[model samples]
Target: MGRGPETAQLSKYFYEGNDISDLPVNLSVVWNGNFIIDNPQNIQAHLYKCSALRESCGLCLKADPRFECGWCVSEKRCSLRQHCPSHESSWMHTSSGNSRCADPKIIKVG
Candidate 1:
């Protein structure tokens, strides 16, 4: 990442776990000159695994071989209930949570 005020801020809170919510919202200055925000619906499929799993382990309350229900129904909740590896807090549960990969602009689709 380019070394600048935005990069510094992103690194400070993102890696250091500093008070991110307290930081200014519009203070970001994109150095890469690219709008890094991603649309939620456009996100990958496996990303929703948590919500899917949490909703229904997909086995009708039984250990169905077809469903093959594992921990936390699926990967999404498994990450959510257990913290997501892709982003901070698996879903930004904390005030200081800030994962550039998991932007809130995403729209959950059915």
Candidate 2:
């Protein structure tokens, strides 16, 4: 589902047991099952954000010390090296315990 301000507002009402309709356009299409957001697979995919969950360089690098996490220097976000859309020059990973992100970059990938 699109995580805009509307989704935030709708989620609040949804989780509170309020009957909801006309979900956010993106969410509405897939939310044809139950009153609550009950699709297990979709919910898991939505909640399990891996790299994106790590908001900053420190948190991103802290995920697995370069094993599963890498920082995208140009984008300024935690991402997986293999899956990162940015250039290879922008990827930073752990080089020994010196694990750091391009000077300040952390070594966490998705």
Candidate 3:
């Protein structure tokens, strides 16, 4: 039997050389047998999402565009009163307040 139009299109994009080895065997049936390849950005995003540091600190060392933490340069944990050159602020101070540093439940990413 011949492939349907949609299937043919998908095959053209993902299996141009008739190589199915790149496709995941478990997910071959997810999108009507379409092979889903993760682009560079998608793979990076997934990595960031699964990262322990990213989850704990809400900061992706590889993906976040903004400066979320100031521990990149410091050799030790800084107190709220200490100045951080990377953050340009006191280590324990966030934009909101000093409670972020005081929170006992906060997980250390490093």
Candidate 4:
């Protein structure tokens, strides 16, 4: 589906809850595509969630809009630019200033 102006070309296919500070575990589902869940119990569960997807990128947010997409962090700085499917796979890095990411790296477009 085509993304609207309010939304970007990419979309987050997975998520987890921030109610609890811990991660999740014992997840059962297809080992492909991103998965969003809540009330995690451990890191292993998150690892599974990460591994389940073919190209899982972006930061795991606790909410939407304020933390919309995969690049939302409420600290001293924040970036609206969605993270690449793979952290290391990305060549760009968002700096603390504007809402967009800087330092663009050329990737081989398939």
Candidate 5:
């Protein structure tokens, strides 16, 4: 990730748990690198985003069955939950009090 004065500032802001409501109107552009100030939420989200290939199964601690072993037998399989082994402990409640796996962007759909 790119690091510099701007990155440091964004990191500090996010670490403080400041509300994003105070962010400027051009939050999308700013976060997209169209401007100097990077949106802290976007940066942190990307940093912690889970990778199916790298993450393992939280329950089994083995290769992620959804992507590798394909042995998940639950009616509501892990894939449906977008499970990320790295965030398993907090899968039910993330920093925002919501499961990141539930995010539409992360969930796989047929």
Candidate 6:
């Protein structure tokens, strides 16, 4: 049996042409063309990242937005504002004003 008229376009979206990255990962049944990832945990697990573990100033500053972490330019460490260098000026996140990391290298994208 074929998909009814209501779901035909959605079926075409998945089967005919769809970016694999755009597929819903949380759903147990994800479809893109003939390939499918059921219960996508492997890729989901990769999503969790600790901001403190980021090695470089740029890496820490450019980290995932979900986790709140800042780069201490002087200390050369990545941590939350409370844990960074014990000085508010040294800690630099995207929103911090008067941050020590005013150099051209530490550009924060809007």
Against the true structure, whose lDDT is highest? 6
Top of the candidates by TM-score: 6
**Model 2 agreement with the true structure over 1-110: per-residue lDDT tens digits:** 76524333234332222232113322333332434554544532121233544767666666644245666777777666766666477766664344464445546688
List where candidate 6 sits over 4 angstroms from the true fold.
Answer: 1-53, 98-110
Pairs of residues clashing in candidate 1: 40-106, 40-107, 49-76, 50-76, 50-77, 84-90
The residue ranges of model 1 lying beyond 4 angstroms of the native Cα positions read: 1-8, 11-29, 32-49, 52-54, 59-70, 73-81, 84-110
lDDT of 1 at 99: 21
Q: Model 3: how large is the Cα RMSD against the reference? A: 15.5
Global Cα lDDT for candidate 1: 0.32
- Candidate 6, residues 7-86, lDDT tens digits: the string is 22333223223222123234334345455656545544222333434767666777665566678766777777777666
Residue 35 lDDT (model 6) = 50
TM-score, every prediction: 0.18, 0.38, 0.19, 0.19, 0.18, 0.41
lDDT tens per residue, model 5, 32-76: 355566566754222111223323333222332322322122321
C-alpha lDDT values of all predictions = 0.32, 0.51, 0.32, 0.33, 0.32, 0.55
Q: With candidate 5 superimposed using the best TM-score fit, by how many Å does residue 2's alpha carbon deviate from the native?
A: 33
Predicted candidate 3 versus true structure: per-residue lDDT over 10-105, tens digit per residue: 342232332221233222233456456545443321111112233222232232333333322242342222344454443432444442422235
Q: Which residue pairs show collisions in model 4?
A: 15-36, 23-40, 23-41, 23-42, 24-40, 24-41, 24-42, 57-85
- Pairs clashing within candidate 6: none
- Candidate 4 ranges beyond 4 A from true positions: 1-24, 27-97
Worst 10 residues of 1 by lDDT: 15-24
